[model samples]
Target: MTKSLDAHYRAVVVGGGQAGLSASHYLQKLGIDHVVFEKNTVAHKWKNERWDAFCLVTPNWQCQLPDHAYDGTDPNGFMVKEEILAYVDRFVKKVNAPVFEGTSVTSLEKVGNLFRIQSSAGSVTADSVILATSLYSQPFVPRAGERLPEGITQIHTADYRNPAQLPEGAVIVVGSGQSGCQIAEDLHLAGRKVHMVTGNAPRCARFYRGRDVVDWLADVGQYDITIGHDGMAKKKHDTNHYLTGRDGGRDIDLRKFALEGMALYGRMTGVSNGKMLFQPDLKSNLDGADRVYNGINALIDRHIAEKGIDAPEGSPYVPLWEPEAETTELDLAAEGITSVIWATGFTPDWSYVGLPIFDGTGYPVQHRGVTGVEGVYVLGLPWLWTWGSGRFLSVGKDAHHVVDHLAAHLDRTRRPLKQMANG
Candidate 1:
């Protein structure tokens, strides 16, 4: 027989990161009683990110909650991983929302418009379930990753801390996202001969016209990315959005590093005799990334023009770091690279939830935040709506919308039926 608990809540939000905390804030604003289930400590990922040198892509001005904004030394300053985690913790404590930290939800099953969530601490039934887990939960490493020669050391970006933690010698950094680029930069700065395995080198601006790129986005209402369909759709194309290099307004550039000696290659194929082999798709992927960057710039230009703002003059386009193509296998022993950092991306894994609502890709099928199975909702998912809701600050307003919708649905759907025993 299943066990039972006396206490009950109107909703249960899983994960206490930015998304979950935002959701809780909104739930309270609407006077909806809810409990948060965090598998690890609050801001678990950010705390563990201790990745020697990690910072937010978006600036501090954009790092905000509904009415609460980041008030610190520099409003336009970029935030470090530790600062971001501390911000989340402070927000939770400020709200005084009931959060059950270190409690992992093992399974969530839907029965008659009421979802039963089973966790290690205990079980609770709520009218709605909010999955605040983001895309960073599951690291997306290729199948060939497992087959690499045993001599090479491999570490995922999630597990990486600093250059000191890596194996001595030349280092290979995989994936070209913000994480990958930052990791490669860190390793290279540590005087380690670094080889960057290129995937998609998207264009990124460092600062825009004397301020952080995030400030530019905010000034142009781009930071309020949560309000429009164009913003939402643009975010969906994640692979294209955050392109590499420096911002249009900054004199600094990443091309300097690539030219300095970061060996760029196509994607990795497999390893043989402790030698790493790469495929020929590197250039093409980079080309695709270029197209995406251009598209974003074009979109931003249009937005600025529509708002009748003075266009900042200068080379908006950052020069590409074109690498010479030479197909060859690399032997680590000769190169002296003891550690490999996998800057590969992340994916959402909802396998433990056991929910009936899922698409062909095993992702939850929902209209907005509502799932097909009643009483089940999802929050904090990147690009959950059109644009703003997935990112940290952008998700706040969206979370409010979700809470209101859920509150109405709960009142309308939930009846005076007997509560099932918690298991």
Candidate 2:
């Protein structure tokens, strides 16, 4: 039997990830009556979806939530997946957030002046709704994956737990993003032959001169730079830097991977005659990555020189190009590659929300989290307000902004009701 209950709230948040929790904190601070509906436990993605070896790419100092920032001794260190989950748990307890665990929202529709939210636990009517589900709700594997051989196993990065979960044979890791490079490294280190489809993803050295590259970027306000300005949308959609937080923070350059015995190929185009087809653009991809890598180092160097700060001189990161094995096609069966892991990235799932606020690309049509429709907002989306909006370092800031907008909206909506009651 479907259990049903009726409830009302001033605002309702749809997810319980970092974005949702951050929004809850601000909403509470603003004295707003709200509830967070999470399909699973708090920080569910960190607890359930990520691999065991997963560690935050950003340093601990960047793990700032609403009122809880990292105050530990290892501010420079990275927190593993378990540590991230526990940190969120502690934050939820500290804030005493009104989060309903295991309550999945099935449908969200605007009914007259109120937003009707149907969840597993019950239905909620709210004056405002904040979709904090972040951008990674759905794993995206290209349609070409469906045509792989029946005997080979295929898995997306979201479903990948560890190398042991895979069958014992060579593995082809598609996409040269952070996840793809890291997984390929894991498989290679686990004694499994690994093949990777390299792309034009940027690479950053873990450390440049005297500090982490992330710190340098932060100091220069690189992350604070807003996207969609001067043709940055294409760069924003590019695959993330080929970097890893594993092995105590290090760069995972694809060229190095190639030198280390991992078969490297260009981007996978399609499957033809039971063989995976790839473009002969490996050198171009390597050059693109090198451009970004050297660009950052140059920025750091310029910063040091301009600020008159004493820093050790560092050489520019040169591309490690290999001339051998420049093939554009691979026979899956002939190479003994038994598994294909797609780390192509993710897309947001908002099918349940029957709102016309989304653009043609399925992304929310909003300006800094405020949708065109009144009382509907989205948080933790890339370029919501800035490049860092979706990151942990800036999610709280975005949440606070969204909450302020929501509060003002409520004040406007409730003023007439109060005036009518008083009259």
Per-prediction TM-score to the true structure, in the order listed: 0.86, 0.93
Among all windows of 10 consecutive residues in model 2, the one with the lowest summed lDDT is 414-423
The digit string of per-residue lDDT tens for model 1 on 1-423 reads 112333567888888887888888777766777888887877777778658566666657767686668988866566766677777667767766567777888888876657778888787778788888876777777766676666778888998988887666888887877778777777777788888777755655554434455555656665544423543544554652442221222322345677787777787777777788988766676666656555555556666678876767434465568656755577877877777888878877686788787777666666667778767778776667645567666677667777777777766876432321121
lDDT of 2 by residue, 140-191 (tens): 9999988998989999998899999999889999998888888888888888
- At residue 122, what lDDT does model 2 achieve? 82
Off by over 4 Å in 2: 1-6, 233-236, 415-423
**Candidate 1 Cα errors over 4 Å, as ranges:** 1-7, 208-212, 218-237, 240-254, 298-312, 316-321, 414-423
- For model 2 the local lDDT of residue 304 reads 87
Which one is best on lDDT? 2
Which model scores highest in TM-score?
2
